[model samples]
Structure formats: C-alpha cells, structure tokens
Target chain A: MMAAEKDEQILAMIKSGGNPERGYRMLMDAYQLPLYRHIRRMVQSHEDADDVLQNTFLKVFRNIANFEERSSLYTWIFKIASNEAFTFIKKNNRHAAFFDKGENADELESRSVSTSQLNGEQIREMLHVAMEYLPVRQKQVFSLRYFEEMDYRQMSAVLETSEGALKASFHHAVKKIEDFIKSKNLY
Target chain B: MEDLRDELKNIGSRLDPAGKNESWDIPEGYFGEMQNMVLVQLHESKSNRPNVNLRNLRSGLYAVSGIAAMLILAFGIWFFAERSHSIDPAGIQELDQDQVYAYLEENIDEISLDMLMTDKQMESEILFDQPQSEEDWDVLLEDVDLHDLNNIF
Candidate 1:
C-alpha cells in the first residue's frame, strides 16, 4: 500500500479505538531502526540505546491517542524518541564516564575495526567527544541535521523550536565539532 | 566540493538506514518473557482498582457503623430516662421543678425578691378589699358542705 493510504488506515483504526498492538507494531516495524540509530548516537551506548528505544515505543503507544496528525507519524515518533533521550540524559548526567568508555571500548573491540574502519571510528570518536562540548540542544540539533539528515522543519517539530533557532544551533554545533576535530588532528 | 558534499550526505544516509532488516538474537522465549511482564503489570493495575474500591467500601462500612452506634446510644439514653420516670413519677415531677428553679437561679443574674413580694402583697390586698356578699358566702358553704357527704365512703 501507499504511504498515504497506510497512514489513513492507521488513523482510522486508532480513531475507532481498535487494538493498539497492530498500529504500534506497524509503527515499530517502520521506524524502529532509524530511531534506534538516532538514540544510539545521542546516548552512545548499545544498552542505553536499546532501553531508550523501548521506552520511546512505550511512550508512543501510551500517547498515540493524543497524536493530532499535525505532523507525519514519523516526525511524531521521532519527537517522542528525542524527548525520551533527553530525559534519560538528564537523569543520568552523572554517568557521563559510562557513555565515553563504553563507546570507545566497543568500537575498539569490535571485529569490524580494520584500518579503514579504524579511520571511520576515529572520526566518529572525535565527533562524539566534541559533542560533549556542545550544549545539549545544540548536540541534538546537530546530530539530527548533519548525521540524521533531518530537515529543519522536521527538527523543529521534534525539538519544539523554531527553524531559525535550529539552524543557528546546527551552525554552532558544526563549528565546535570542526574546531575540536582540527585541534585533535582528526579527519 | 559539491560532489564531496553530496558524497558525504550519501554516506550519512547510509549511516542509519530507514529499514536495515537487522535482527538481534535474543534468548529463547524472549517474547514470552515480555508478554509475561506486560500481563503482570496489567494484573497489578486491575487488582489495584479493586483494592481502591474495597477501601471505599470499608469507609462506607465505617460510616454505617458510626450511625448504628449513635442510634444504639440514643435508644439506650431514651430507655434509661423512661425507666427513671416510671420508677418514681411524683419524685420526678418534683425533681423537674427543682431543676427548673436551679437553672433559672443559676442563669438569671439580677433577680429581685422584693419586686416579687410586692406583687404578691398587692394581689392579696385587692382580695381582702373585695366585699363578701351573702350569695358568695352561700356558694362557698355549699361547696364545703357537699364534700362532707363524701365522708361516708
């Protein structure tokens, strides 16, 4: 089926208070991996990312009744996932060491770490380390824009901020990451 | 440079696929475990609802118990009062009068016996000044004489 038709059918089922499992499963099947990757980048740990992903889906399930259809279902789910990620970070801000060490160790130990892969991991590590220097909202905007390739309007819906402000945040974040990468001699 | 940007964007796109078809291996019966967890939470919520209802019922029972106790107390008081009244009717009447007089004496701050005596004396003087006619005397004698006939009983 086409995207529009599928969305309409999902909306109709939701409106009729039908089994939420079907709709939720559909949503999970469609957006789980992208959201998982997005959360993984933000949180930088596989375990934490998994937890946040589950929580995001649970939140989406619980709050699907209030979805106003103002944005695409994709955007709505991303918004929920983003909020859950921020909340997780805020609650576990004291555990910053956990994020850094785990990502580094996991990247180094993985069997995929060839010389080329090492270069990619190095760049990823530099970006991840520089991400710590940026403000939380800026990091989120930067990741979504540059890494996730989300447009400004979609990000505005997710972050509940103006597009202009998102643009500025992305600009600042990119500059900070670039400076950090240059200073560290990371390509 | 534009080509590099496009290439970078393409690489970024590949970084996170919309549908990766990647599946993680879980322990056996992971879905069952998850389903069990959900069921446990559902049961908790369901059970908690009844507990709240029971709490409300307990409160209602307490209210009913209070009303019943009050009714029993009222009935006991009424029963005791009636028993006392039946035991000594004349004594109770006298006790009621004494209670009334004691209540008035305790509550009334500025009572004057002098005014009460003066009112009684004035009424007596009026009675003494009234003429005693023969017809009035005859009626009085008749009232007293008729009671003498009751001495036979």
Candidate 2:
C-alpha cells in the first residue's frame, strides 16, 4: 500500500477501538526494522537498542490517543524513537561517563579487530567508537544523515529543528567524523 | 553543502567502499518474539489503567454523597427553625373540650385561674388568657354573654 493510505488505515483501525491488536501489530511491523537499525547505530549494542526500541513502541501505543496527525506518522514515530534513545543514554550515567572520557580508537581497533570476522565489520566498529567523541546532537544528526541517509526536510520534522539547522549540523557532523577517521588512520 | 557531501563521500568510499556488507547480528527469532513481548506489556498497561480511574470514581461518589447528606441536614435544621419561629406565643389554640375537662378534673385544686393571675389581669382578660391583640378580644367576646360583659365592666 501507499505510505499515506497505510497511515490512514492504521489510524482508522486504532481509532475504531474494535480490534486494537491488528492496528498495533501493523504499526510495529512497518516501522520496527528501520527504527531498530537507527537505534543500533546510536547505541552500538544490540541489547540496549532492543530495550530502547521496546520503550519507543510502548510509548507510541500508550499515547496513541494524543497523536494529532500534524506531521507524517513516519516523522512522529521516528521522533519518539530518537527521544527515547537520548533519554536512555542520559539516564545511564556510567555509559554517559564512558563516552565522556573518549575511547582510544587505536587500542579499540587493535583489540576488537582480532575478534571481528571481517575487516568491514571492524571498520564499522571503529566508526562507532569514533562516533562516541561527538557531541550528542551531532552524533544523532550524523547517524540520521550519513547512516540512514535521511534528507534534512524529513529530519527537520523528526528533530523539530529548522531544515537549515539540520543541514548545518549534518555538515558539521560529517566534518567531525571525517576528521576522526583520518586522525585514527582507521581507513 | 557541497563540501560536506564531498567529505561524506570520501569517508564512505574509504571506509565502506563496497556497501553490501552486513555488520550487525541478531539472535535467532528476536523479531518474532519481540512483538509478543511488547504487546503483552501494552495489554498490561492498558488493563491497569481502569483500576486507577475506578479508585478515583469511588472517591468522587463519596464526595457527592457527603455533600448530599450535608445539604439534607442543613435544610432540615432551617425548616425546623422556621416552623418553631412561625408559632405565636399568645395565639394559643382552643383546646379540645375533653382534654380541658380531664385536666381540670385531675388538677382541680392546683389549677385555679385565680391563682395563676392577678385580679387586674383577670378583670381585663375575663379569666381566659391575656388578650394581646384585637383577635384575642374578638375570641373572648365571642365566647362571653352580653350580661357577663356588663357585669365585668
């Protein structure tokens, strides 16, 4: 089905309140994979990403009544997921402190590459570790832009920032990540 | 924008030149199991919601009933107060003849109209009760003979 039509159908089913499980399941099936991948890129741990993803969906279900449909459902759901990610990270002070004291990428690469099955996987890990050095918003912007390849307009809706600001943040994030990879000689 | 794009392209080319490789792994049956887990939580949360609202509803009912009881009590007091205030002290009703005769027979010695009043009040009121208004005078006049009034005067 077309995206707009799918959204309307899901909303109608939920609002009808006759069979909620169908609507909720449909919503889950449609958004889960992309949201999971996005969250995984942020936290870099499968377990944490799963937890965040669950929290995001639970919130969406609980607050389904308040959804105004002002933005596209895609933007609305992603915005919830993004906020959940940041909140989870903020609440885990130990994790926050670890990221605060930036990891040594060279050491991380040397230790992690031995266990990694492929050079590509190791490079991705290195990239994830390098991402830890970025400020939180920049890292989020970079993940949405570089990894997810979302345009500034859609991102603006999700992040609730101006398109110009998102573009600027994405640009700055790219520069920072490029500098980090070069500095570490990960390439 | 162009410069940032170039930088991103360079990073992408150097790091993941062939982008077809999958780097992440998941345990078997994770996605299939996750739907059930989330749905269970959703059901649990929604089910728990009505209990809180029921508690609130109980308290609200109690408050309404309490206010109703207070209103009833207040109205009762005001009604009784107005009823008692409406009675005029001097405007006593004509007693039943049997009740009056029975009381007179029981307390014949103690119930002298003379002992209960001064002679002057008896002369002015003609041995019934004080005539405080024109209605009382009229009632007394209706019960007395013209010869008795001439004798009293």
Interface RMSD after interface superposition, each candidate: 7.6, 3.9
lDDT tens per residue, model 2, B100-141: 678779999888778657888787765465778998888767
Q: Candidate 2 residues A40-110, lDDT tens each?
A: 76676778889999999999988888999998888889999998888877786323222363434446656
TM-score, prediction 1: 0.54
Runs off by more than 4 Å, candidate 2: A94-108, A111-118, B1-22, B51-153
Q: State the DockQ of every prediction.
A: 0.06, 0.17
**Candidate 2 chain B worst ten-residue window by lDDT:** B13-22
Enumerate residue pairs that collide in model 2.
none
Regions of candidate 1 where Cα sits further than 4 Å from its true position: A1-4, A94-118, B1-153
Give one digit per residue, the lDDT tens place, for model 1 in B1-153: 343246445443222222222223334653344444444554465467545587889999999999999999999999998998898754645566779688668867666545435767866764445458988666655657556768856
- Which run of 10 residues does model 2 chain A get worst, by summed lDDT? A94-103
